[model samples]
Target: MIELITATQLDYFDNLYIEMKGDAVERDDYIVAETKRGFEMLRVVKSNYRVPKDNIVEPDGRFVRLATDEDVKAFDKNDGMARESLSFCKEAVVEEKLDMQLVNAKYTLDRKKLIFNFTADERVDFRNLVRILANRFKTRIELRQIGVRDEAKYLGGIGPCGRAHCCSTFLGDFVPVSIQMAKNQDLSLSPTKISGACGRLMCCLNYEDEYYEDAREQMPDVGQTIDTPDGRAVVIGMNILDLVVKVKYKDDYIREYHCDELNAVGEV
Candidate 1:
């Protein structure tokens, strides 16, 4: 697997999977390259971007050797230009009264293309806006409309967990999340409580789902009838994390017992 820099101090691009030959590339090697977007300078990364054998995609271009001092200077200049281009795009959006929120911008390493990212509630007519930016930058201009989740992934911030967002830091691609996952885990259905910064179900829900699912299948659920050492009882509560069930006896006494201690008679 070949690696490429996904982000820089000011710009964020999806980590690209490149196909390179021989031992010419190594981790942290800076090189000029052409990507699907345009010409770019990407550094090799240690982690691989894996793909299924059936639908593997090829790299845009081959690595063009390790970077030089001149390449470093060129990248620095491009970085500064990208920031300025973002500012310019924002002003243009305002002037045109476009229904869009500009997110970020990037300039290709060869300065032949400028890409702008934005989010909007609905489709935006950006034909005129593109012409404005094209004349200003004197290059091919692309305005990409993305979803809220993608916007969050691009401009990251602290999550509800008081740490960096998973999307920006480590998540390579987003997986499907559903509210039922929360219900299965017995979480509060409150949207504000369960949703993430992306305003979708917290991705962490998928992390331990298998464990909860297996435990639920193997154990009796709350409100189910069960036979306990004390007597016939109804399950009152549960701690899935601890693999324990709290039961209320016919005498109205409640006791927590290991899952194995209770024999399931029937579900509620």
Candidate 2:
């Protein structure tokens, strides 16, 4: 049977979906998969489940088999080596005086490639550094430049909400988040309030943005004049979720009324 296996590599934490023709696998089980990068050892986050072929386009890769004891030992050894390589790369960066922050290093399952992920503000010249790393590791070297958001995903942290970072947790992909989303939700425009630990607009802001956009269309904006049962009132505030608007009448007495109970007259 074709089952969906959600797995991730220790080197790269992003969850990947793989289709396997197998009975079933439990969560946290180690499995081998053939990916574009080559054979990779992946830890299952979600167990195998039957998925209709018509539902999903295709999985990221095809699963090979469950990892044997020898495979696990090799994976552990590779992880240790990658960590050591990262430390050495960091020292090399310091010595070279390169303006880049090394985030992680990893070796492919076959030890054919050593990949390094780093973050830099501007264009970096790392030809000399690459040569140094190639000589030290005695393998194919790959230097990847990543953004701050991807770096945060690599190095997980607790966000301002006191929870683990979404990117580091279950977020398989990063969606586009904009300042307009914050505005649509009537949130304060403060960067500190809206930005995530990665210093980018919070991904959660996109979660309820569609709902708020629909609510805004149904509700009148603040400072708009609307005809209420009491009289013509100026909208002072709004509860978008509840479709409730607070309005002030000619006498300056404010009252709350549902959007359905009011008629839009015009802007105040």
Candidate 3:
């Protein structure tokens, strides 16, 4: 049977699923897994469950083993060192006068590589910064320039939705969000209302867009002249969810009618 395990780190947002052939593991158990960055300790977020091999794509990483006491110690040490490295890197950025905002840093579980994630408005020449970090840490250095969305993912916070940001909680990857999505849903064009903590269009805008788009196909646009049961009226507003349209007649009286009760005449 294929045993599926879900695991995550405190500092990172993405969950990693590991597949293995072994006894079931309990939630909160620490385990070693081979990831793209090498073997790292991850805490089990969900209990292991049996799944069909064909039901899932290849797992994110292979299970190495249950974490040993030594592994936990090493994980703790690495966490501390990674924080110190971030502090040092921030100082180096100031000293070098680099126009970049360092978000966080981490070391490979084996201490073979020190990785730094940063954000910048424009291209930043960080060759000297990398040299300085490599010399101080005495490890291979990787400086990654990430977008504003990624920065929010790394430093998580509650979104405007009054809950944790989706990208920092369960979203595996970001979907392309655009202003068109806001318009599709008939949402306010105000930036603050439609934008997320990252100052980009909220990811949730993409969730119900397909439904709105389909509904729009069956409805008349605002300002359109349509033949209502009463008479020809100018569409003034709409409640897309209920398929309701508000319109004004030649008498200047507005009335709500189901979209099904109206036929499109032409533009007002």
List ranges where model 3 is wrong by over 4 Å: 1-21, 25-30, 43-60, 68-70, 260-268
Residue-level lDDT tens digits of model 3 in 114-170: 888899999999999889988999999999899999888888899887999887776
What TM-score does structure 2 among the candidates reach?
0.84
lDDT of 2 by residue, 113-207 (tens): 89899999999999999999999999999999999998888888999889998888778668999999999989999999999888999999999
Whole-model Cα lDDT of every candidate shown, in order: 0.77, 0.79, 0.78
Q: How do all the candidates rank in terms of lDDT, highest first?
A: 2, 3, 1
**Tens-digit lDDT track of model 1 for 209-228:** 88888888866877888887
For candidate 1, what is the lDDT?
Answer: 0.77
TM-score of each candidate?
0.85, 0.84, 0.80
Task: Pick the lDDT winner.
Answer: 2
Steric clash count of candidate 2? 0
Worst 10 residues of 1 by lDDT: 8-17
**2 versus 3: better lDDT goes to:** 2
Q: Which candidate is the best by TM-score?
A: 1
